[model samples]
Target: MKPHIVMISPALANANNGNWQTASRWANFLRQRHAVTILPSNDPETWSSIDKPDLLVALHARRSAAAMEALRERYPDVPSIVVLTGTDLYRDIHVDTSAQLNLQHAGRLVVLQEAGLQELAPAWREKACVIHQSAPSLKPIGAACKSRMPRFEVCMIGHLRAEKDPATFMQAAALLTSPGIRLTHIGGALDAELAAMAEATAAAHSHYRWLGSLAHDDVLHHLRRCHLMVLTSRMEGGANVIIEALMCGVPVLASNISGNRGMLGEDYEGYFAVGDSAALAQAIARAAADSVFYKRLAEQCQARAFLFTPEREEAAVQQLVDNMLNSKSTNRNPFP
Candidate 1:
C-alpha cells in the first residue's frame, strides 16, 4: 500500500495566495507516488476524523501549529514536515512561541528559497532544505501583440496588504511621467486602508488600474501580456509570482530583500531598496525606456528559470519524502 500523507494548509483555493498555491502544487506532485490529502488549518475538527497519515506536511509554522501538535500527540512516531512562509521566517518565528516550537518539533524543515535557510537557527539547519516553487512556462506575448498603440504595460501581482507593500507600487505609478507607460495591479485588497489607497491611486493616476482578484489563468494571461512585473513585497518566502513571471517570459523589478535576492541573484540589476517607491519608479522607467537593460534583466531571469521547473521541484519533493520514510532514525537528516 502506498504511504498516506496529510498536508495542512492555512489558505485554501478560495484564498488564492502563495500558501494555497504551494500546498496545492506539492500535494499534486506527492500524489503521483503517495496517497495525499490536504486539510485546512482552520478546520481542526476535520483533522481528527481522518486516520493517522504516514507523514504530515504542514504549511506555515504558526497557523498549522495546532494541527502539527495534534498529529504529534496522536502518533509520536509519524515524522512531520514544516514549510515556512514569509511571515513565519521574517516575523512570526522571531516572536511567536508557536512558530518557534513548530520548527523544533518538525522532523524536517523546508524553505522555499536558499536565503530562507539563513533565517533558521543553527541547530534546526541540520534538517532544513530549500524547495523552490515552480510554474508552467507560457509563450511570451510581445508588447506589439498585446496592444497596437505601442504601449508599455507593467503589472504588480499580490493582494493589497501591508506586507506586500502595494503603497510603493501605487506611489511609483503616481511618479511615472510617461503617458505611454501603463500600470496594472492584480489582487484583491486584504486590508481596507490599502484598498482605499489603491482606489485613490487609480483615480489619481490615469495610467494605473487596480483589477481586484483575477482568476489564476486570467492573472497569468495578464502577466504574460505585460512587458515587466514589479514585486514590492517587504518579505517573502520565495514568492510564487516571481516564478510565474519568469515562466511567462516577463522580467521583474523587485524590492531588494533577502527573499528577492535569493530568487534573482545578488548581482541582478533590477533591484530597488525595500519600500523605496522612487527607486522602484526609476527601475521601471529604465526597463521601459532602455531596451538593452530590459534585455539583460530578461536574460538574467531566464538563466534562473531552470531552477523553477515543475519536473525539478517534483523530483526534489519526492526524494525528500522517500528519504524521510526510508530512514529508521528520526534524527537522520534527509537532505544533503
Candidate 2:
C-alpha cells in the first residue's frame, strides 16, 4: 500500500489564499504516488478518527505549530515537514515562540523561493530546500488583440488586507493621469478599513474599479486580458499571483522586496520601491505609454517561465518525499 500523507493548511479552498492554493496543488501532485489528505487544522479531536499518517506536511510555521507539536508527541518516529511562508520567514520566526519551536520540531523545511533560504539560521539552512511554486501555462493574449481594447487595463489580485498593501495600488489609481489607463482590483476585503478605502478610491477615480473576491478561473481570465499585473505586497514567501501572471504571459510590476526579487529575479526591470504609491504610478504609466519597455517586461517574465512549470515542481516534491521515506538514519533531516 502507498504511504499515507496528511497535510495541514491554515487556510482551505474557501479562503482562496496562497496557503490553500499550495496545499491543494501539492496534494494533487503527491496523489500520483501517495495517498494524500489535507486538513484545515490539526485538531486533536479531528485526528482521533484518522490513522497516523506516514508523513506530516504543514504549511505556515506559526499557525500550524500546535498541530506539529501534537503530532510529534503522539508519533515520535513520524517525520514532519514544515513549509515556510512569508510571515514565518520575515516576521513570526523573529518574534514568535511557536514559530521558533516549529523549526526545531520539523524534520525537513521547505522554502518556496531560493531567496527564502537566506532568512534561515545556518543549522536550519542545512536542512531546507527551495521548491518554486508552479502554475499551468496559458496561451498568451496576442498584442493585436490587446490593441483593439479602448483602455490599457492593469490588475492587482490579493485579498484586501494590510499585508497585501492595497493602499499603494489605490493611491496609484489616484495619482494616474492617463485617461485611457484602467486599474482593476480583485479580492475580498479582509479588512473593513481597507474595504472602505477601496470603495472610496473606486468612487473618486473613474478609471479604477474594485471587484471583490473573484473566482480563481475568472481572475486568470481577467489577468490574461490585461496589459500588466501589479503586486504591492509587503511580504510574500513566493506569490501565487506572480506565477499565475507569468504563466498567463502577463508581465508584473512588483514591490522591490526579497520575496518579489526571488520570484522575478534581482535584475527584473519592473519593480518599484515597496509602499511607494507615486513610484508605482509612474511605473504603471510608463508601461502603458512605452511599448518597448512594456515588451521588455513581458520578455523578461517569459524568460523565467520555466521555473514555475508543474512538471519541475512535481518532480521536486516527489523526490523530497521519497528521500525522507527511504532514509535509514534516525536523524529526521532528509536533504543532504
Candidate 3:
C-alpha cells in the first residue's frame, strides 16, 4: 500500500502566495506515487476528519511549529519533515522561539537552496538537505518575430512586500533614461504602502507599469515574452521565479542575496547589491547596451538549466522520501 502523506501549509490556493505555490506543486509531484493530502494548517481538530497520515511534511518552521509539536505527541512513531522558507531561515530561526524548536522537532529538514543550510546551526546541519525548487519549462517567445511594439521589456514577478523590495524596481525604473525600456511589475499589492508607492511611480513614469496580481499561467506567459527578468527580492527560500526564467531561456538580474546567489550561482555577472537601486539601474543599462554582457548572462543561465529539470527534482524528492520511510519502517518496502 502507498504511504499516506499530509502536507501542512500556512497558505492554500486562495492565498496565491509563494508558500501556496510550493505546497501545490509538491502535492502534484508526490501524488503519482503516494496518497497526498494538503491542509491549510495543522490543527488536530481539522485533521480529525481524515485517517492519520503515515508521514507529515510541514512547510514553514515557525508558522507550523505548534502543529509539528502536536503531531509528535499524538503519533510518536510517525516521522515528520520540516521545510524551511526564506523567513524561517533568514529571520525566524535567528530569534523566534517556535522556529528554533522546530529545528529540534523535525526528523529531517529540507532547505530550498544551498545557502539555507548555512543559516542552520552545526547540530541541525546533518539533518538538513537542500532541494532546489523546480518549474516546468516554457518555450521562449520569439520577440524579434512578434509584430508588437518593440520595447526592451524588463519584468519583475513578486508581490509588493518589503522582502520583495518593489521600491528598488521603481527606483531603477525612474533612473532608466532609455525610452525603449518598459518596466512591468506583476504581482498583487501585498502591502498597502507599497501599493500606493507603485501607483505613484507608475503615474510619474510612463514606461513603468504596475500590472498587479497575475495568475500563474499569465505570469509564465509574460515571462516568456520579456527580454530580461528582474528579481529584487531581499529574501527567498529558492525563487521558483528564477528557475522559471532560466527554464524559459530568459536571463535574470537579481539582488545579491544568498538565496538569489544560490539560484543564479556566485559567479553570475547579473547581480547588484541588495536594495541598491543605483547599481541595479547601471546593471540594467549595461544589459541593454552591451550585447556581449547580455549574451554572457543568457549563456550562464542556460548552463544551469539542467539543474532545475522536473526529472532531477522528482528523483531527489523520491530518494529523500524513500530513505525517510525506510528508516521508520521495519519492513523496508521499496518505494512505489
Candidate 4:
C-alpha cells in the first residue's frame, strides 16, 4: 500500500504567494508516488480524531502549530517533518515558543537552503537536511527577443512587506535619476504604510511604478521581459522568486544573506548589504551599463538555475519519501 502523506499548509496549493507556491509545487512533486492531501492548517474537525498519517509534512511550524501538535499526539512514532520558513528560521525560533516546540517535535527537519543548518541549536543539528528549491529550464529566448524591450527596467518581485523592504527599491530609484531607466514592483502589499509609500513613490517618481498583486503567469511574463530582477529582503528562507527570476533569464541583484548566497553561488558577484539602497542601486547601474559584468551574472545565474528545476525537485522528493518508508523499523513494515 502507498504511504499516505498529509501536507498541512496555511493556504491552498495554487496560491500565487510564496508559501502557497512552495506547498503547491511540493505536493505536485510528491504526488507521483505517495498519496498526498493538502489540508488547511486551521481545520478543526480533523484534530478531533486519532487519525494516524504515514508522514506529516507541516510548513511554517508556527503558523501550523495547532494541527502539528494534534498530529504529534495522534502519531507519536510516525515521521513528522517540519519545513522551516524565513521568519521561522531567522526570527521566530529566537523568540516564539510555538516555533521552538515545533522544532522539538519533529523527527526530521528540512531546510530549503544550506545556511539554515547554522541557525539550529547543536542538539537539533543532526536531524537537519538541506534541499535546494528547483525550477524547470526555460526554452532559450532568442537574442532578437531582447530588442522588443522598450526600456531598461529594473524589476523587484515581492509583496510590499517589512521584510521584503520595498522602500529600498524606491530609494534606489530616487538615486538613479536616469531618463531611460525604470523600476517596476510586483505583488500585493500586506502593510498599509508600505502600500502608501509605493503609491507616493510612484506619484513623485516618473520612472517608478507599483504593480500590485499580479497573477502568477503575469508576474512571470513581466519578469521574463525585464532587464534584471532585484531581491531586497531583510531575511529569507530560500525565496522562490530568485529561482523564478533565474529561469526567466533575468539577472539578479539580491541582498547578501545565506538564502541569496546559497541560490547564487558563494563566488557570485552581485550582492549588497541588506537595507542599503545606495549599494543596491550601484550594483544595478553596473549590471545595466557594463556588458561584461551583465553577461557574467546571466551566465552564472543560468548555470545555477538547474538546481531549482521541477524534474530535480520531484525526483528528490520522491526519493526522500521512499527512503523514509523503506527505512522504518521492522515492526512497522508490513512485509517484515
Candidate 5:
C-alpha cells in the first residue's frame, strides 16, 4: 500500500516562486510511489477534510507554523517534516518565536543546502537533512539559434525585493564598459521603489532590459539561450535557478553567500562579494572578455550537474516518506 502524504505550501501557483516550485516538484516525485496532495495553506479546516495524512511536509517554518503545530498536537503519531526557507534559516529562526517553535515541533527537518545546517540550533541538528533541489536538463540552443542573440547575453532571474539585491545588478549594468555584454533581468516588481529603479536603469543603459515576471517555460527557454546567468540574492536556502542553469550547461556568476557557495563548490571561481556592484562588474567583465575563464566556469558547473538529477531527488523523497510511514507508532485505517 502507498502512504498518503500532504504537502502544505505558503505559495501557490500564482506566486511563481521557489517555495511553490519545490512543493510542486516534490509532490510529483512522491506521487510515483505514494498518494500525494498539495495544499496552498495549512489551515486546520483544509487539513481536517483530509482526516489525517500519513506524513506532513510543510514548506516555510514561520508561514506554516500554525498548521504544523495543530496537526502535531491532534495526531501525535503522524510524522511532520518542516522544510526551511532562506528567510527561516538566515533571519526568522534567529528572531521569530513561531519559526523556532516549528523547529522544535517537527519530526524531521529539511534544509535545502548544506550551509543551512549551520543555522540550526544544536538540538535540531541531528534531525535535519540537506536536500539539493533538482531541475531537468534543457538542451542548449545550436550555433544557428545562438547567432540570433547578442554577443554576450547574461540573464538574472529574481523578483525585485531587497534581499535579491537587484540594485547591485543595476549598478553593475551602469559600470559595464563592454557594448557586447547585454544584461536581461526577469522577475516581478514586488517593491515599487525597486521597480522604479529597474525602469530608470533600463532607460539610462542601452544594453540593459528589465523583462519583469515571465512564465516558467519562458524562463527555461531564456536560460538555455543565454550565455550566462547571475544570481544576486543576499541569502538563499538553495536556488533552483542555479540548478536549472547548470543542467542547461550555462555558467553562473553568483553572490558569495553560503547558499551559492554550497551549491557551486567553494572552489568555483565565479563569485562577487554580496551587494558589491564594483566587484560584480569586474567579474562580469572577466567572464565576457576571457574565453578560457568562461569555459572553466561552464565546465565546473557541468561537473556538478550530476548532483541535481531527477532520479536522485526522487529516490531521496521516496526514502524519507517510507521511513516516516514505517515509524508511525499508532494504528490507523489505511487509505484506499
Candidate 6:
C-alpha cells in the first residue's frame, strides 16, 4: 500500500487563487504513486479518517493557521509541512499572529521563492525550503507577435488586492496616455477600494482596461496576444503568472521585490521600485517602443522558462515526496 499524505490549503476547490493551484498541482502530481487526500477545513473530525497520512503538507500557513493548529493538535506524531505563500512571508510573517504560530507549528516550511528566507528568524530558517513554482509546457504560438500599431499592449495578472498593488498598475496607466502604450489588468478584485481605483484609472485612461477575473484559458490567450507582462505587486510568493509568462516568452517588467527579483535575475533590466508609477511608465515605454530592449527581455524570459517545464516540476515534486516518505515503511498487503 502507498504511504498516505494529507494536503491542506485555504483555497476552495473551484477558486482560481494561486494557493489553490499549488495544492491541486501537488495532489495531482503525487496521486499516481501515493495515497493523498486534500484536507478540507470545514470539519476537524475529518482529521480522524482511516488511513492516517504519513505526512501532512499544508499551504498558506498564515491564512490557514486555524486549520494548521487543529491538525497539529490532532496529528502530533505525523510530520506536518507548511508551505508559505507571499502574504504569509512578506505581509503576515511580520504582522499576523496566526502566521507566527504557524512557523512554530510545522516540522518543515516551504517558501516558493529563495529570497523569502531573509525575512524569517534564524531559528525558523533551518526548517524552510525554497521551491520554484512550475509552468505548463509551452504550446508554441505560431504567429510572430510583432505589433502593427503604435499602441503597445501590456497585461498584469493578479487578484486585485492591497498587497497585489493593482493600484500601481492603475497609476501607471494614468501616466501611459501617450497613445503609444495600452495597459490591461486581469484579476478579480478582492479589495473594493482597489477595485474602485482600477475602475477610475481605466475610466481616466482610454488605453487602460480592467478585466475582472478571466477564465484560465482566456487569460492565457490574452497573455499570448499581448506585447509585455507587468507585475506591480507589493509582495509575492513566486507568482505562477511569472512562470506562465516566461513559458509564453512574454517579457516582464516587474516591481523590484524579492519574489520578482528572484525569478528574473538580480540584474534583470526590467525592474522598477514598488509603487513607482513614473518609473513603471518608463519601463513600459521602453518595452513597447524599443525592439532591442524588448528582444533582450524576451530572450531572458525564454532562457528562464526552460527551468519551469512540466517534467521538471513533476520530477521536483515527486523527488520531494519520495524523500519525505523515504524513511517510512508501507504495508505490503495484496488485497484488503
lDDT of each: 0.90, 0.91, 0.86, 0.81, 0.86, 0.79
- On residues 1-336, what C-alpha lDDT tens digit does candidate 6 reach at each position? 888888877785567878888888888889999888887655566656635568888888677777767777776666667888777888887888888988886766778777888878887787777777887866644335445545577899998888888888888888774666778899998888998988888787788999999788899998877788999988888888999888886789999999888788787888899999999988888777678998888887777776677777788778666665653335221112
Candidate 4 lDDT tens digits, 1-336: 667888888777445677788888888887767778878888868656535668888888788888888887777777777888678888888899988899887766778888888889975677777777766666545546764667777899998889999989988988885557779999798899999999998998988899999898798888877888999998898998999888878889999988788779788988899989999888888877788998899889888887888877777667666666665544343111
| Candidate 3 lDDT score relative to the true structure | 0.86
The estimated TM-scores of all candidates read 0.96, 0.97, 0.95, 0.93, 0.94, 0.91
Tell me, by TM-score, which candidate is best: 2
TM-score of model 5 vs. true structure: 0.94
Ranking by lDDT: 2, 1, 5, 3, 4, 6
What is the alpha-carbon lDDT of model 4 when measured against the actual structure?
0.81
List the pairs of residues colliding in candidate 2.
187-213
**After superposing candidate 6, which stretches have Cα over 4 Å from the reference?**
41-51, 140-143, 328-336
Can you write out model 1's per-residue Cα lDDT over 81-181, one digit (the tens) per residue?
89987888888998999889989988889999899989988988988999989998888876557556467899999999999999999999999896689
Ranking of all predicted structures according to TM-score, beginning with the best and ending with the worst = 2, 1, 3, 5, 4, 6
Instruction: Provide the lDDT at 220 for model 3.
Output: 90
Candidate 5 worst ten-residue window by lDDT? 327-336
Winner by TM-score between candidate 4 and candidate 2: 2
Which is superior by TM-score, 4 or 6? 4
Query: Number of backbone collisions per candidate, in order?
Result: 0, 1, 1, 5, 1, 0
- The numbered model that scores best in lDDT is 2
lDDT (10s digit) by residue, model 2, range 105-198? 7878999999999999888898899999999999989999998999999999999998899999999999999779999999999999999999
Winner by lDDT between candidate 4 and candidate 1 = 1
Model 5, position 186: C-alpha lDDT score = 96
